[model samples]
Target: MNAFEEEREMMLRVQQADFVVVELTLYTDTHPEDAEALGQWREAIKEAAHVRRQYEKRYGPLSLLSVPTEQAIELGWRWNSTPWPWQR
Candidate 1:
């Protein structure tokens, strides 16, 4: 595939993850007895985590909705404490 096609594919995968999260949340809430659905939810969550790590490695950190991107900021704390989005 060309670059455009590759980028489109990546965007589609991202959208799929978003859709999966919504569906899994509703499914798990409504049908608590479905082990398979729960397993799917776990897989979707793992996928989201993997995607997050990939983006953080390639690009900068994606700060929380409450916080802005910290790419332009300096470290304000010790080594034990990272920026807000990355803090443990």
Candidate 2:
């Protein structure tokens, strides 16, 4: 696959992990002391972050918060050329 396709796939993976974490977070709010849920949430968060970093390294930044200094310096206004992560 091309770089764009690969990047989209990685972004999808990260999105899935983040969704799982959010779901687990809501469950933990009710359960409070569910060790298993908490552990799964932590794992999901870690996996999401790792995939995010990988995406950033391979394909520019994913969001304003995760923007790398090099990307800012190198790409400047070119980021607008690409579609947003949530967009088709």
Candidate 3:
């Protein structure tokens, strides 16, 4: 695949992972006593982090919460760079 296609696919994966984490967090909030849901929520958080790291390693970062890599710095990626998430 070309660079754009690869970036889109990775971004989609990151979005999906983040969606799962958010949903699970909401579920756990109302069902805190459910051990199964709590476990799933924890796993979701880890999965989201993994997906985010994979994307950021190549595309700089999705947000400032992530520390920029040396490679990203060398590539001249900045927080205010164009094609932000909505623009993308």
Tens-place lDDT per residue, model 3, 3-87, is 8888899999999999999999899999999999999999999999999888888777777677566656678766677877556
Best lDDT among the predictions, by candidate number: 3
Q: Score residue 46 of candidate 3 by CA lDDT.
A: 94
Question: Which runs of model 2 end up more than 4 angstroms from their true locations?
Answer: 73-88
Q: Indicate which candidate wins on TM-score.
A: 3
| Model 2, residue pairs in steric clash | none
The clash count of every prediction, one per candidate, is 0, 0, 0
Backbone collision tally, model 2: 0
Model 1 segments more than 4 A misplaced: 1-11, 65-88
Candidate 2, overall lDDT?
Answer: 0.78
User: What local lDDT does model 1 show for residue 55?
Assistant: 49
* lDDT per residue (tens digit) for residues 24-84 in model 1: 9899999999999999999998897676555443334544431233433443223234443
Model 2 C-alpha RMSD to native:
2.5
